[model samples]
Every structure is written in structure tokens, then in C-alpha cells.
Target: MLFSLIAFLGLIAGLLYLATGARPLKWWRPDTLVAHDLRTLPYMLSYPFEAPDSRQNIIFDSASAAASSPSSTTPAPATQNSAGAAAAAAGGVATPPNTPPSASRAGSHAQLVSTPSSASIGTELPGIRAASLDKLVQRLTHHSISDANFAANFLMTYRAFSTPAELLEKLIHRYHVPLTPSSGRGAATYDKDFVHPIQVRVCNVVKLWVKTGYRDFVNNPTLIARLKYFVALMRRTGHEALADAVIKSFDKQAAKFAADEAAAARLAAGQVVSPASGPSSPASSQPGTPRPGTPVAGLPASAPSTPAHGSLATAVAASPAAPTSATSSPAILKTPVSRAMNAHIPSRSPSKEEIIASPIPMMPPSDLVADITSFLNKKQGSATDRMSRYTAMLCSDSLDALEIARQITLVDYELFRAVEPVECLEQAWSKKDKLTRAPNVLAFIKRFNDLSLLVVSCIVLTPDIKARALVLRKFMLIAQALRELQNFNSLVSIVAAMNSSPIHRLRKTMELVPEKVRQQFKAIEDLVGASSNYKQYRTRLHNLDPPCIPYIGVYLSDLTFIEDGNSSKVEGLTNFDKYRRVASVVREIMQYQDTRYNLVAIPAVIKLFSPDVSDELGINEDKAYENSLLCEPRAAS
Candidate 1:
């Protein structure tokens, strides 16, 4: 029995060893040499007198290995070699005799590291270190998935670290790296066989840069010229496809810029630009029909049709109205007796004919409050009937969280896209005259706050614990859907509402929430959390494609930092850097605006979002807190 027990224990140990891949034993007796193993193995093989400091010895050994294998790899260019020598000197490492200065400059001592060895070109780096310009270019032009991802990120955010001119220069230098074969080798064979792949990758990188970040070239004439020259060089070298793609992207951006300029010119001239009246609009399709909002000769001037809501009409309306001069009014109305008569006249609601006949200025709805005034509105029926309907739609098990999220995103996206880049550039949304300067931005903010309050109201107003939990779960699911939809604007709003004091303090209600939901909520919280300055949220946002609505607050904060931290002039020169940085942020905001969602708008779901109904739902922060107390009273002190 004792032998059997021992045997059983030994078998269990053997299984664990296999399960762990025998890692513990391998630590003491490694099957292969690794970086850490090198620290001791060299000393172990050397005589006592020859022993050297492990770290420095490792550097020395690398230098020696590189020096001995000169023909095994391509030699770095003269510029790189000099930079590596400078880096080695700066690091206090002595260059070895009989070794080329570049050879003595190991990867650890980098002024600028040479091109990576062929084996390392497409492989993942073991760890991140400061790479030289040449190394960065190599990585940017490498043919590997990991390298492609790195290239995308670098191109997207490179403005923050390097100037466009500097990057362009590096790319040109990489393109010109000598491809001449060694003596006695056929130049044609070397050019055709060896140099072709390198040239292809360089051209591909340039094409990607132009395709994804053409704005960089568009905003700078010098860069544009440089890019054109590069394209010409590429064509001369036989990369016609990539060269053509670069030129096509630039031309596309130019056309878009021209269209924007035309739109701005029309706006400035007081012309109403309809959103639906694009190049392919029905009005354009039939040239005979006058566009909506345009005055037809036969129609009375006051009878010009009103454009759709949330259109550029809002922007036009927000502009300061022209003051009515006393001379412009009738003499009788200007007189004191006439004014007295006007004061005595009782005010009345405008009739439909009167409202239609009145010259309505293009603008946002003047009323700040939603149409849904109260629960007791006569049109909505008796209070009990209203409650039943609300419960049926919101609290019923038939609620489609994803559909709800999509509808919200649809509305939110319209508001988001309406924001013009100039509004952000001028910081108009934060100004006291925001109504006049950034009406669309203000509208978006209003929607965001209203959504947050509505979320709170829904959860706290439910009288039953189970129903409240159900509402909470529904919202959590909606938040998940929002995240999936890449609508961070609404996602952050809902998460903020869920985290509000009123909803968060419901201990019993929260306890009833399922564990899976709780975990999901936790993840959502982490994603939108303010920790590390919203690092996780920013990372996730950068990874997302367009048809997304990012939280404007992040961009606003970035603008604030740029405005406050940098001076407009540095040493009497225009601080172009500050403006460049601001433009970069604005471009990112505009980038997402160009892509509209493909989701079909449901009339019923949209009706629920009607401003009137939303207001009637009583989406007030104070009311939410009161409802929370009524649902679950405070604990005894």
C-alpha cells in the first residue's frame, strides 16, 4: 500500500512536469541558450583571469560577432555608420581596434542602429528599444503583419513625434540606399533580384501614407511638391501602380477640399445649402426643379420652404441676426402712440397659416426644452394609460437593446456630423456666444447630457426592484451595443449615468443584477474610466474604423491643453507648431465625420427619441435623485 501511494504521487508529479512543459527544471538546465543564459555561460567557459563584467562582455561579444560577419549581411550606409559611431562614443563604449566603427556599434549603443539583419527584418522585436531613423524606416517598410500594424499607428500619430519633412527625408534616404552588388557580381542580376523587393516596400509605404494621411501633404505645399517628386521617382523605377495610387489619393483629397471651399463660399453668401442636395440629389438629377429653400420667382419671398431640422439651417440661424433699423419699420410703428397700442394687444399663438407665411430664419429650434412637457399631457391620455404604455415599451421583455442603441447612434451621429471643424478650432462651443458660434456643437452636448439624465431617470423611476434591475440590465446591454457600434459619445454618456450617485447607491437593486452583467458593466467602466487620462478609451478609439462617434470631450480637452500650454508666438515667430498640433486634432475629428452610418432609421424607434417625448419623460438630474430616494430610502445613520 505504501509503495502504491508513492507511485501514485510520482505519476502526479510527472503529469505536472509535462503540463508545465518542464519549465522549472529547464530554468536550472536550459535546453538552449537564451539572453539570460549568456550572462553566465561566457564566464563559465572562460579562465578566471579572463572573466569580465557580464553586461559589458555581452556588448563586446556582439560587436565582435558583427565585425567577423561583415560579408554575411549588407553593409550599412556611411551616414548610418557615422551616426552609430557617435552613439557609441556618447555611451562611453570604446570602439575596438581592427573592427569598423559601425561594427563596434552594437544594437545596445545606438546613435542610429544600422538596417536590421535580414533574419530580423520580418520578425517581431523581442522588446521595444530606442531605434534610429534608419531602423524606423526599415520597420515601416517591412513586409509583415506586425510591421504593418506598427506602420499604421506610426503614420497616424507621427505628427506628434516627427515632422512631415523629416519623415519624408528618411523615406527618400531609404529609397536611395545603394543596391550595387559586390565586385564581379552582375549589376542587372542584383538590381532585378535583390533590389526589387526593397524598392517595392518603400513605394508601398509611401502609397499608404498618401492614402491614409494625405492631409499631411494637402496642408503643406512643400510636402506636396516633395511627394510629387517622389511619385515621379517611383514611376521612373517601374512602380506604376503604387505611384498612381499616391497621385490618385492626392487628387481625391484636392477635390474634397475644393467641394468644402465651395460650400463655405455658398454659406458665406447667405445661400441655404441642403444636406440632401448633394451632387447626386434629386434636385440635381432633374435640373428643372428648384432646390428646396431656394426662392422661386413666382412664390412670395416669405413663402420659401423651410429646410429639414439639424441641417445647415441651424448654423445659419445661430449667426447674429441683422439689427432692425428704426428707419426700416413703418413710421406709425415707430411712434410712441403705436408702441403703446402694441403693448396693450394680447399675445396669441400663431395660426398655421400665419406660422407658414412668416419668414422663418434658418436656425435650430428656438425652444431648448423637448416637446414632451409632462406625464400629464392631455394628448398622451390618462396617467395610468401613459404609465402602461411606458412600461410596455421600456420595461417590457421585448425590448431590443441593440436596436435601441442603433437608433440612439443614428440620432447622435447626425448631431455629431453636423459639427464643423471651424467650431472646434475656434473653441466656440465653450464660448458664451456658443449659440451663435457653434450651434451644432452645443446641440451635440445637449443631446449627450439629455441621454445621460434619461438613463438615470429610467433606472431610478422604476418602482419595483426587479423592474429596476431589468432596466439597469437593459441599459448595460445598450452600453455594450454602443461600444460595439463604436459610438463612444453615447457609450460614455450611458456609462456616466450608470455610475452617477443616484443609480450607484442602489445597493439592493445592484445586487439583483446578474453576475455576467456585473462583469460586463465592470469592463465597460474600465473602458470609459478616467484613470490614466482615459488611456484605455483612447487606445480603443484609435483602433476603430469610421462611422464612429468619438467622445468630443476628449478632443475638447486636447484643444484646451494646446491652447493653454503653448504661446501663440515664440521668440517673435508665429508658433506654427501650436497651430499644427491643433490642426492635427481637428483633422481627426473631421475624419470620422465624412463616414455616415448605413443603419436604417426606424420611425417608431425615432419617435421615442422625439425631443417632446424625451422632455416629457422628465429627464432631470434633480428628479433622478429624488426618484432614487423614493425607490430605496437612505440607511439609518
Candidate 2:
């Protein structure tokens, strides 16, 4: 029995060893000498001292080993003596008998060392493991988009057989799967064509790579080199779609980088980077689009001819072979607003009919408070009936909803226009100063909060699980629509309402929410979450075509951060640079005031969202939890 137990333990140990060395074993199979040589290194170390006699020498005979080594097995590059021979051949001079090769002062040595070929540069470094890197490269064309994206991102993320640039170069030049366009040189039929298995796979791989990895490529010099280098190669190899995708991605990052660098340089040099240098929104573009490089009205081109280091100039300079058009003069791309967030202005001016503004009346805090109380008192319906009315409000026409959003933005711009950024920063100005200077700003924030509170109350008060679920679900849908409409003002309020403590704490009601509805809510919640400083929201905001509402909270918070973190002056001089950056954001928000889309009447939604006596419910955290437990008691195990 003891013998049998010992045998079982020995088997387990052997299995563990095999499991750990599985890949190594595969790499160092019987036919492979590579791993065998690597593994033999510790045992192959030379003695520190020379052998006492020639016969006792430990080192193997070079001639015998060379002759015995299999001809089919390639020698490592490091073992080659080509460099010495090449240097001697180039100079046509043999080394002097007394002179050691290292001691020789030949110009050929300098010439050979100074410039390195791509292959030599790559091979000289300890690069990624071929087995793993090749595996990853193979997976780049995986059937699943997520798998393909994962492989592409991972390839650039980890350092392996070569630097990222060299590895990417290998992927493009040595291992790239070619994508065939259905028609040569014509519009790409690949988008519509379903045939060509390998071509389709390659196209999808490239598309996902560019879409997912563009940000990394833009930020990383090595990846940038890889992107630019591979793009040209792909284009030459007749993969137009892949090449175009790279160009499109690079163009966006490059343009933004160039504009920012120009602005930063101007600021550092104590020159006012003109607002015109900021990217112009298409919404603000005049009847005739301004020509590239021309200064916008009311702003002058202040950027110096010479760009400083770490700027887009350096990025562009690194890739001189890239097209001149691809790296257009930085001045042309400059505008006060982010190019990504540039609102899509109507190609033709807004027709007179589309120019209606929201009909929601802007009232003072006291008036709004009274109006809300009056509306609540006059409310005449059961919770179910109220939900029916709420559904109708949620189902408001998309255009009308957009108009409401526009109106809200209009009011937002008007109220906050006079509130300087400094007032929002702690220690910069007192709370009294903020209120005195911009009472409207305070009123706007209060009204939105009140509306949010009211919505939460309405949902929490509705006792029926299905009715509450319906109301919550409808609100989620409306919020989504508001996001699509780019009316972030309303969207923010709706989201805040749904996520309020009372509504969020309703365990039983929440359980009644459909799985799809819950997923949709989670998605929207992620968008507005504080993660990455609301990066998802900003991305979505930028992606939407203009005629959208700017989320006021984001911009306000931005100003607050800028004001608190930075001083108003540097070296006793007014820091116009800080002011300029702040002004650009403010100007962009103000620009929305001119939007032509106006809100049509949706009285039910307006009333539903308006503050009510429910605001006095005082639903604290403890109360919410208590109410939640009452509705859905935890099951005893």
C-alpha cells in the first residue's frame, strides 16, 4: 500500500512538470536543436582559467564541431563572422599581423557600425518569442471580432521578438493576409460583397485593428511608425480599405495633435493663441466654409512658424514620407472647439420652419417652485393612470424632444454665459459672488435637481411593480432618445432621476424590469458614470451629429477643475493661455444658442418633469432601504 501511494505521488509530480513545460517541450521537440542549445548553456559554460595543457582543453574543437554539425540546421546570426569579412572586403585591406582587430583604427569599422540595416537592427535585439508572437499574429484574423481585436491590441501592447514597430512591420510585410476588392480600382465592393472567405476575414481584421488600436497608435511613437509604415505597404499591396482605415484614424489624431501643439507653443511663448486657432465647429461655419489656413473672423493666426519639440511637428517630422495633404498646415485645423465635438451644421441653412425653439418657459426659482407645487396639487389620476400619461410623455415625438433639448441648451447657455469660470473655483470667489453674478446659473441647476427629485418620487410612490417597471423602462427609453438627439441636458436630468436613491433602491420593482431594459439602462448608466472622468459620455457626445444638447455638467466641471488647479497668472503676467483654453470651451457652449431647432409643445412631459410636492417627501437613504426590504423581503435560507 505504501509503495502504491509513493508511485501515485511520483506520477502526480511528473504530470505537474509536464504541464508546466508543455510549451517548452513543444518548442524543443526531438528534431529541434534550438531549445537543446538554449537548455545546454548552463552546462556549457567555459572554465574561468585556461586549461593547464592543450590536450586538457575543455572547449570543443571548432573545425570538428563545424564539420559534425548538420548542414540543414541553421547557425545563429550571432555566431556568424560576416561583419569582419564584410569590413575587410569593403576596405580591400587585410589586417596587419601585429594589430588586433579591435585595436585597428579603420574607417570601415565606423562606417559599418554607424548605419544599420532593418534586418540587423531587429536581429541584434532580444525580441519576442516567435512561438507566441506568431500565434498572436495568426489569431489577428480570428472569426470573432472581439478575438481579432484582442489579438491586435495584445500584439502592440506586449513587447516580444522585436520592438512594436518592427513586429508590426513584420505583420504587414511578411504575414499580412491580403484582402481582395471585388472590382479593381473602383469603389470598394468589399463592404457589400459576402464572398471571398480569406479576403473578408482580412478586411474585418484590419477594420477592427484600426478601430480599436488607433488611440494607441496615435499616442505611441513606435505604434505611429508602425501604422504609417504599414499603411503604405498595405496600399501598395492593393488593400485599399485597410490603408484608408489607417489614414482616416491617423488623420484624426494627427490633426488634433497638430492643433494642440500649435496652441501650446503659442501659449508657452507668451503669445495669445487666437481662438481662431481652435477647431471650428461645422455648426458655426459661415455660408462659405473658411479656406484652410485662413484665420477665423475676430481671431488672428498667432502660432509661430517654428513648432516646439514634443509637438505634432515632431510627430509629422518622424514620418516625412507621409503625404503633405495628410499632414496639412496645422493652422488650417485649428479652432476654439474640439474637432471631434464639432457640431454637424446643416449643409444648407436651417429652413425657417425648422427654427422653432423649445416652448418650456424659463422661470425664476421661486416661480418654478410655485408652478411645480400647483401642478402637483392639480394632478388627478391613479398611479396606473399617471404611468399612462408618463408613457405618452416618454413617447413624445423625437423631433419635439430634440426641440425641447435645444430650448434647454438655449436657457443653459443664457444662464451660464455671464458666470466666469473663476467664480466656480473654490477660494477664487465666494458662493455669494457666484450667486450675485449669475443667478440664472443657480436657478438652472436647482430646477434640474428638483425635476430629478420629482421623477424619483413619482416612480417610488407608484405601488404596483409592473406599473413602476413600465414607468422606469419608459424613462430609460426617453433618456436614450435624448442621448441620440444630443440633448444631454434632458438626458442628464432623466438619468439622474432614474439613478436617484429612491428609484434605484426599489428592489422588487427593479426585478420586474425586462432583461433587455436592464441592459439598456446599464449601458446608459455606464455612459454617465464618473469612470475615466465620463470618457464614455464624451466619446458619445463627440460622435453624435450636431443639433445636439451639450451636457452642461461636464463643461461646468471642466471649468471648475481648470480654475481650481491653475493660477490666473504666471510670472506676474496675465496668463492669457489659461483664459484662452477656458474661453474656447465657453464659446463652444455659447454657440449652441444659435441652433435653429426649437422644442414643440409636449405639455405632459414638461409637467411630469416639473418639481412637485413630492419634493417634500424627504426620502432619505435609510427610508429607501426600508421601503426596498418591505417590497421584496430576503428569503431565509
Candidate 3:
């Protein structure tokens, strides 16, 4: 193709030389040729979604206004198509041969869809062969779906400091209040959450008979059953007000749990090294010590503004205890970075070995098992004092190291399940120890995570203190529910009491993200990188689904509160990354016409972009309105 184009240009050059006396193909300079090709290339477009009735598609393209009168030539309803000509004609308007394609575009950090494909499942998606993944999305978002406020009890873990997996065990023993089942409607009628789609429900029955129960089918044909159990792991961070299954004694239960853990850590301190003698080898252990547990009493109350609070101080303290055996790193934490992550773990609860090896393995790793041992071996103060001292010694500003260290540590408690003994972090729950923990220890650990998150949240969202504070209150509750996850079972509903906290609303979207994206784009990254350009886009999402950045939402909410009087030049947004994301979501709204904002609510499908987006999109305002450039579309998305 390139050779032919060059030859054609050469022929044109020869003709010019013969007729007009042009000496050479100067127009064919590499830069000129490249520029010419770019200018002449055809525009690209796509249509990622098509409504059930072509009329709906017409409405999006402004056919109602274009046609003027719907009653004059109103034709019978017709099937929907990407072109949507029938819809236009039905309203007495001639269909423009080319309709602007509502195409899906590429997403940030596009990752593989983990669900089993239809071919792998041996057949098409049952009950909802409706081309769009929207058909199978669960619809637990009815008016009755509300979050119950459970944020105040346990700050980090729902069962923090509890010996038994109280949360999981509850799921095992309890019966979830029944949800409204699928209404035997078409694929156009559902959503994706606790509520099951009609198709999925039917497929589950078939899967039981063919794949698990009867084992009679030749090849497994039910995709629903193959849908990983991970789908069931839904969270609601936007609503801190709604508590689905309210616990009666949450605060009391949590306080008791905290007390027990504090005592145990105190005992560990006493047993490891007595205060009179100090640590066995303090000089050898803390190689680069930074004022272990010493007070900076003269400083003001607001002095400890480090990007991260506890982890680094621990890392500095644990320098001598770096785990030696390679196996100390979980088999699941296969990445070298994940292995190196253990170097700066800050606060892990109770303490256990195999506990960290579960679902999300290797969170908030400290220097290593060896590092943790050494830190503990030479430590002489209470855990909170150690943490407070560490907080004081940190650099006065946020940094990459602080954020990475914080996230890695959080990954352990919030996600990873440690397989090996991590006495510094994990704790094997015994009925006995659950009763003896110090309440203050639980508060310190929980606060450590919360404060770290707050710093990062400031980076991701509004720097306003009030908003960050409100969001934080809600996030703390979500962490409480998670604390009880070890006892999680199929029988219990994992709904957090839906609080009004907007952060609670977006939890589902944030939680199940692939481990890699989660690690990189955490609270701190979001605080710093969620620039002004991304706010409106994110706000649209928060209104739609609050948990978009649940963890960061807490901190941003807090920052909003504190900086009500601050004056900063808030930059405006022009990039389409956030808008593009919102566009895809609008399509999802279109899928189920019965949503809070039905398709009819969209008066005009305006492709909003600042003047800046226009340049990148390669078109002017007039042309851009009637066109959207898209190169790819996802069948699942």
C-alpha cells in the first residue's frame, strides 16, 4: 500500500515536471507526505450500543426534534438498529444516510475481562442473548435498595480484633432477607449486584443440573455458573447511612475487640524485651533509627503532616528483620515489587501466619518476616506510641515512598490473605485473645489506616476538609464490615448498612478491580492525579454510583471541610478520559430504560468536551457535534 501511494505521488510529480517545469517531487518530503496522509485519512466511528426499539436510538440523535411531528407519519414501532433509520422515518423525517455512531472508545489501563467467554461455556448467554452485557447486569438498585449506616463501630475491619471470623460466620449462619427476584422481563430489565438477572437465575439452575449436581451434560454450557464467585463480592461505599443488616452492639463489640488486641500486643512487648533493659540489640535492630516513640512536644497539634504515618517508621525500625527465606513472600505475590513491598509495612492487626495467605495475599508487607521480628524484638514502647513516634519522624510532606508503603500495607489487611506467619500484622484469632486486646491498640491501628488514607484522598479529590471528613466517616464503616469477612459464607448478604456517604455508593466499582490497577491508583495517587479536569467527570459518576473512589472519597470529603476558606486557582478540565468513561456508563443507563434517569431524560446526547479535546479529536466544533471518533468497542463493556 505504501509503495503504491509513493508511485502514484511520483507519477503526479512527473506530470507536473513535464507540464509546469517543476524540477522534483519536493511535495513528497517525508514530513509533507506524513502530514498529507493524516489530513486525508477517513474519519473513524463506532456504535457500541443499540436500543431495543429503534425509536430510542432516534431520540438520542435528536430525531424527535428533527422530524417535528410524530403523529403525522408515525409508523408502527420497529426493531432497533445502529443506523436507526426506521425511528427517524416513523416521525416523518427522512433518515440521514449516515447517523453519528455512538461508539465505545478505549478505557484507561484496559485489562482482560476475567469471566468465562460464551465459547468456553459451550453456548450463548442464556435468557439474555441480548448482545449487550447490560442484559446480564444485576438490578439491585431499586428504590428499596438502601445502605444502612454501620461506619461508626469498627473503623477498619468489621470484626477488628475479634478472634472468630464473626462476619463470615454470620453469613454462614444467617439468612439474607430475600430480594425481589427477576420479573420475567426481557434482557432489557436488570442490573449487576445482589439482585440476579432472569438469565443468570435460569443458567444457575441449568449449571447445577449439568455441571455440578447431575454431571450429565457432554460439555458445560451454562455461563452463569462459570461467572466467578467474585461477582458476588459487591460493596456499597457511597451510602454510609444504609445498614442492610444492622448489628445491635457494634461499638461495644468493637471496643471489646480492640481492648483484647492492645493487651496482647502489650504482652508481646513485655515478653519480647523488658522496658528496664530496653531492646536486646537496639543499635543492631534500628540501623537508621528516627527517634523511636520520642515526643516532639513543642510542635503544634497539626504538626505531623507526613504523607504516610506509620509504615515507614516501622520499616526504618524493622530494617534488621528483613525476612531471609524467599518463601516469606507469598506465592501469589509473584511480582518482584510485591516481594519488595514487605519492606515498609506499617500496621497489620492482631497477628497470624496463614491468615495473610488467603484471597488477597501479601498486603502492607513490612521489610519481611525477619524485619517484623527484629522490630518487635527491639521495640520497648506501646504500639500506638511507636506509631505516633513514627508519625512525628516522617518527612513533613507526602512522597511516592509514603503512598506506596501505605498502599502495600493496606493491601494486606484490606485484601491479601497471608499464608505464612506475619506476627507483625496478622493474628490467629482464638476465643481467648479476642477477649484480651487493648482497646487503645485497635484505635491506633484503625486510625493509622484512616489517616494514611486521608492524606492520599487529598491527592485524588477536592482538597476541601469537610467533604473529606464526611467521606472518611463513611469509609470507616465499610472497613468495619470487611473486618468480619473471614467468616464470609454464601448464605449471608454482604451489604454494608448503606450510609448516605457518597463514597459508599461507589465501592463495588473500586473493590474488585484487578490487583495491579488497585495498587497503582490508590488513595494517594487519586488525591494527586485526580486533577480539576477529572472532577466533573467523577462527580457525574459519584452521583450515578458513589464508590468510584470510595477510599479517597473519604479523605477528599474531609479536605473539603477543612479548606472552605482557602483560595486556589482551580483549573478547568478538557481531557476526554473521564468523559469517555462517563459516556460508557450512560450507555449502561440506556440498556435498562427503567433506570432512575431513563433514556428519555437525555434531552440531547451532547458530546461534551472543552476546546482542548477538539484538537486531539481532529475536528472543529461543527463537525465534531455530528461525529464521534472511535476505534474499538467491547462486547462485554
Candidate 4:
């Protein structure tokens, strides 16, 4: 019985050692071990597995303590997790969350005990931890539905964060990581099903990178060579279709790059460059002659090839030769009608003689104001009459707010889309010389300011309180319509105008506004309110799909913040972080620029909102306040 008990105890001990992977007692081990035995033995001692939540709390507490300490008052650097630290040691930045350890090192001997489940990978994306470069790349190649969108954004903005060489290196390293189990001890082994998917995804990511950001490769020969190397590997591995796609994209982008360079050269040489037909033919480049298709100043590209109605030249020629006055120089027209007509002219580069000629007589400010007012009245009659005409022209049912909103959207869209990417570079729109430096951006901003002023003027200039209240209500409905149409630019302008001092001070008029309208206006105010740095507006903007006209001021402010917050370079290398932030914002702007509103343009409405007409109608804040006082004078103290 004693012998049987001893044998049973030995059997139990052996089973326990096998089940738990426990080491034998020190006394049981041989004094000298073979090479195979040493290789099989784990190098590091294993510890009890701790829950991720417990580990996370510990890290957070340490970080919080460090942050709150008075002795270390300066802002702490980005906290690097263990995996990130490991990656940093290997000549890279932090490893992104959910990335495998094998890819983090080039020839690392460290082993992964277990692979994370597929479901757990990429589930924590877009979080702070995932902002790391490696995380971004991992997410870009992820199989999640949102990965495509994330990839596009990263592609658009990656230049700010990383260079082509660094990114390509990471991508190649990730692709070459061993997916199959290794015969060597302690080597990682992923599921066979998961392995194929990851490899395929890496290839897909490369294809997408080529398709979306081909410009990077076009501008850099080194990148193209590296890409070819990757492609050669892909071909060797039997990924012929994917390899073919990559090669084809490279060829296509290379051709496009060559064509673009040629076109730019032609443009620099004072030759016409057609968008559709490439560089203009030699026959079209007659010296000193502008191309017929060339866009005229202050006119949209879609404007009629013929001269505008009542063009300055026609008006000047048709006017009965007015008797010359000592006060009126030949260059200066006397009649307000003629002056207003001449103001609509498309300005062009002045000829040598015109530039050197005697200056035109300047109109006194009072006379200028009088002329503008008279011109506006003659063109559209009184404010009330103009409102009626606009309402009639824009709305089929006279008060069809949706149609009014659509018309405003169409006009705003035209101005918004006309702004070029170059106009916003370096905060050109905000500079003192913005008129020349950023003509398109300045024009867009000017329209916004004018629209805001116009809204305030319409309310305060109304003689009757009831009519003013009705106008206010109409604007409120238009704001709501703008919101629905995703025309946040115009929506904010109208909202701001309604909340301006002149309009807001009208207690009686505001009292007449319906509760529904007031509530709607309140909601709009909440949406666009400056509180919390316009967080609500930004959130709404993010949730919106394409074909949106985002408030330009928000993006401009973002660019400004990026420019002010970060240095342009670090250690003589370009500061890609700043570039990344700027590119992210600019990418959004470019995306919106490409998406157009579906609403049809109305010629009458378009003319009404034209820059010239808008300037004439856009009263100054002081004038608006004066009108407000006239409509409803303050009670004597």
C-alpha cells in the first residue's frame, strides 16, 4: 500500500508540471545542459498574468501623479508604453496599439507568448494610443469598415507625420513579418486563417497608398525604387494581380507627373494651359492676346463667354456724352447711374498708358454712400420691395423657406468652391495684403461678411416693427434650411447677424418673433456658439458626409493654431507633425471644395448676391445701429 501511494503521488506531480509548464526542482536538473535543452528553456521568468484593466489603472495613476507633481511642473512628454519603448529602442517611434511585437523589431529575439484574437485587433482605433505612427499604419491596413476612411485621411495627411521612406520601410517590414509558426522555440505563431488575411490586407494597403497618394512617389525617385523592390517581392510571392495594379498605378502617375511638369513650364513661359487639352497649341499663343476661354477678373469660370449685361464699356459708349465739368475729370463719371454701371465692369490688368495716366477724381465718402444707396434703390427699389422681389424670385409660394435656403446654398457653394488651395496657404487670407495674396479666399470671406451685414441691415432698415419681425423670422427659417442643406458657412453668417448688437437690441421686434422661430434661433446659436472653442460645431461637421460647405472661419482658425503651435522644422528635418495637422485640416477643405451642391443656380438670385450688389447693400455696423435706433428709439432716461 505504501509503494502504491508513492507511485500515485509521483504521477500527480508529473501531471501538474506538464499542465502548468512548471520547472523541475533545482536538485532535479542536471549540472550541465545540452544545447537543445538550453534553446528550449525560456530565457525570462514568466509572471502571473495580470488583467489589462489593473495594468491600465497602474499606468494611469503613475502618469497622473507625475503630471500633478509640482517639482515636475513642466508638461511631460508623451507616455511610452512597454511595446512603444521596445519599438523606440529599435530605431522607430512607439508601436501602435494592436500591432504585433514581431513587426516592431527587425531581427528581435524576443518572443510573443500568444497572439491577440482578431476581434481584439484594431478595436481601439482613433483613440489617443492609436495616434502613434505604427498604430496609424496598422489601422490603415485593417479590415474594419472604417479603415478605408482612416486610410484616406492618413494618406492625405501622412506627409505631416512621416516621410515616404520611413512609411515604406514600416510597410515592408510589416509585410515580411513571419505569419507561420517557426520551428525555433519561443517563436510567435498566428492562426492560419488570420495569417492570410493580414498578409492580404498589407498588400491591399500598399495598393491603396499608391492609388491615393501617388504624388508622393511621383515626386521622389527613391520612393519609386523602394516601391518597385516591394513589387518585385510581391511578384515573387505570386501576388501577380496586386503587383500588376501597383506597377500600373506607378506608370499612370509618372505620366501624369510628366504632363503636369510640362504644363507648368508652358504656363511659366506665358503660354495658355488648358485643363482638358493639355498645353495650348502654338497657334493659340499669339503675343499680347488673352485667350477667349481665360477667366475674367471678378467673374466665375462658368460665366458667359460674352460680356455681362450693362458692361462698363457698353454703358460708357452708350451714355450721351455728358457735358464736362471742372469737378469731373474725363476719367470720373458724374452720374450715379453711370458710376454704378461702370462699377460692374470686369477689372483687368491696366495697360501701360492707363497705369501712367492721371488719377481719377475721388468721390467724397458722403457722395459715395449717396451714389450706392441711389444705385441700390434704382436697381431693386426700397428694402421692403427688394425683399418682396427676392422672395418672389426665390420661392414659388412666396414664403417657401426651403427654396430660399436652396438658393442661398447655391450662391454660397459657388463662392466656396471658387476658392483654390493656394489661397489658404500660409494664412494668406488673414494677411493685410489678402486682397492680392489670396484673392479667392478673400472673396469668399468678403461674401460672408457682406451676407452677415446684409442680414442685419434687412432687419434694422425695415420701417415697420411687424415687417422687421417677419424678416427676422424669414432669416431664421433660412438658417434652418442652411443647416439641413449642410451649408454651415451661410448658416453661421445669418445666425451671427441675427445675434448682432443692432438686431439683438430691437426688443419690440424680437418680441413679435414667434416662439417657434425663437426656439430655432436658440438652437442655431447653441450650435455655433463660441463656447468650448466651437466644439459642438466641430462635432457636427465631422458627422456630416460630403457635399458640405463647412464654416471657413473654423478651418482658418485651425490652420492658425497649427501654424502657431508648432515649429516648421526639428533638428533640420521637416516637422512632419505640424504638416500632418495642417494637411488634415486642408484635406477637409479640399474635400468640401470638390463636392458641389446639387441646387440649380438662379440668375436673378445670383445677380442679387453678386459681390458688387452685396457690397452696395452691406451697410456698416454704425449705419445698421443708426437705422435700428430710428426704427425703435431708446426711451428717455
Best by TM-score: 4
- Taking the tens digit of each residue's C-alpha lDDT, what string does model 4 give over 344-391? 111122233322221122222444334334544477567567655443
Residues 370-478, candidate 2, lDDT per residue (tens digit)? 4434444566666545544444343434323344343344333323332323233332233655554434455556656654655665566555677667767666666
Query: Residue by residue across 435-522, what tens digits does model 1's lDDT show?
Result: 7666667778877877787678777777888888888888889889898888999899988998898999898998898989989979
Off by over 4 Å in 3: 1-533, 536-637
lDDT of 3 by residue, 47-152 (tens): 1111132232212223222321111111112222232222222212211122222223321111111111211121111111111111111110111111110010
lDDT of 3: 0.23
TM-score of each: 0.45, 0.38, 0.20, 0.47
Please tell me which model should have the higher lDDT, number 2 or number 4: 4
Q: How far is candidate 4 from the true structure (C-alpha RMSD, Å)?
A: 24.3
> Once superposed on the true structure, which residue ranges of model 1 sit more than 4 Å away at CA?
1-378, 381-388, 571-573
Residue 246, candidate 2: how far off, in angstroms? Answer: 48
* All candidates in order of lDDT, best leading: 1, 4, 2, 3
Give stretches of model 2 more than 4 Å off.
1-430, 612-626, 633-637
Which residue pairs in candidate 4 collide?
96-135, 160-576, 160-580
lDDT of each: 0.51, 0.40, 0.23, 0.50
lDDT at position 17, candidate 2: 41
Assess candidate 2 and give its lDDT.
Answer: 0.40
